[model samples]
Target: MSADPGSPSAAQVELDGVERVFHLGDSDVHALRDLHLRIGAGEYVAVMGPSGSGKSTLLNILGLLDRPNGGRYRLEGRDVTTLSLEEQAQVRSRRIGFVFQSFHLVPRLTAAENIGLPMMLAGIAPRERAERVARALKDYGLEDRARHKPDELSGGQRQRVAIARATIMAPALILADEPTGNLDRSTGVEVVRLLEALNARGVTLIVVTHDPQLGARARRRLLMEDGAIKHDTMAAETV
Candidate 1:
């Protein structure tokens, strides 16, 4: 998946001839078929599809949580498909961030601890990690909730902590899987705005959602069906 020759910015993500297959018992299920996609920096993309349409599979591959059985994935001009598990983990930690519907915060960790987990895992110095976590807590309006555990926070607060944790490394890309699925309408709207704000600040944001309303908020939309991109708003706009 190459960037358009005339495009201004470089592609942040590229997938070419990507294929993902899963074997269950005696059958093989094709999760993604010849999937090709290119997303530029600072773009806001929404991936929407029915169940079993490979939306989750696509997100997994993008986040390096899973690999495609066939094809190439290039991130920031580097072909990551060939990278080993350790190498992929390194890239994932430094370049990609993930926000999940469930928040996925460690139950025992406080909000500040959760936001600092990535830096801690990457072996960042304690002083630096503490400073970054403090900044994140303030940036996300979680300063007062710093010592509260996940179970002690509200839905919106929990999601804010997850987002702060995800972006603490200043990743080039943010992969959000149903980020607002767990919140009520108003809270979900707030979470979506926070994510959009990140995109506004030049972070590539890709969100997977079942809500049409939520999907519509993205600048570009990819509609997938049967393991293939059925519609691309960007392509449509160009025509």
Candidate 2:
């Protein structure tokens, strides 16, 4: 559970009549169909569905990795749907963090280095990068594994590093797509707790998962079918 039941903050995400279509061999695949959704600041949301249902497409649009073919998307009150590619990239770098199923850590980089990658890309000074990375390492309990590469770390440690890296930019929104897909049940539990801890600190968390048990833990659950949300409900009694 993330956002409080009576949150006063404005919406962090807003979509109006959103549509996404992919053209494949003269066939139009409607990935998202007139979708409209809003997530308030600090909300924790889980999107769930079968493989072809469009949960990934919706997450992509929210993360600014994919643009919608039609309709408006406002992120933090700005019209992101109309942003140029460069502008969108800038926004993404500054305000969004992404966690993927594969962990997405650079194979060659040490855990500390990977955690600091975003700041490095943004041209942060070395001292600042070092300070932030060190703090993140401690925050994620990765100090002992700082020098380890992704291959050297266990599944849970790697995911912790990925999460550290994702949040090092101080992103307002964290988009996790199947974050625990590659991990065992206990490790997945650890990762989910880490995500929820960040959410407790007021960062908006949106996770895409097929696991029903995991989805039930969120304050809000959305079920997608046929490129649209079939169900959207807040927890009556949080699990």
Candidate 3:
């Protein structure tokens, strides 16, 4: 377990006066309202809220997939809000990893290829990419399934591959949305434990889950309501 919300530093993520708005028919919808929060490096945090609480919107903004209508987003002391679309995509590809509830593996690609996809996109050297992919496959216990396609693997195995793929780029941050949503209880726990292992190695992890039991496992739990943070509690670190 980590500390109880240890003091955030320049290395941490800062969201200052973030706002997101969308137009719905003839009206305006405020998805996020002047949200300000900081998440330190190596922290395993969970965000919880109902369906319409702007959880996905916030996650998208954090992941750099969507831009905020207003506010500055600084990642590792660099202002990224003003970057061009291509630059933002590059930053996201190089700095962030994403794991969604639905394993987004391409049906045509093998497990090994899927794990190496990010590195391939980043134009990493073939030998280095191969090395990382091998390690990732072995680390996630997918070596035996390296040649198998997603359709052939079990749910747990597919999720494992997804996790491996997410971290193979050695991303600074991992954003997981309902990672365990499609798995059984035992398998879900296993998946989460694998994620925690990565966090233990210093990658910032933020998980969005609707399950209280799952959220409670994190050191910091953020409760959201109506597109705003209702409460954020730092629990005693679990030994």
Best candidate according to TM-score:
2
| lDDT tens digits, residue span 112-227, model 3 | 99988888999999998888788778778888999999999999999998888877766788899999999999999999998887787787889999988889999999998887
Model 1 lDDT per residue over 43-96, tens place: 899999999999999999999999999999999989999999999999999889
RMSD after Cα superposition, model 2: 3.7
- Candidates 2 and 3 compared by lDDT, better number: 2
- Give the winner by TM-score: 1 or 3: 3
- Rank the candidate models, highest lDDT first: 1, 2, 3
**What lDDT does each candidate get?**
0.89, 0.88, 0.86
Candidate 2 residue spans exceeding 4 A from truth? 1-11
lDDT of predicted model 3: 0.86
Please give the lDDT score for candidate 1: 0.89
RMSD of each: 5.4, 3.7, 4.3
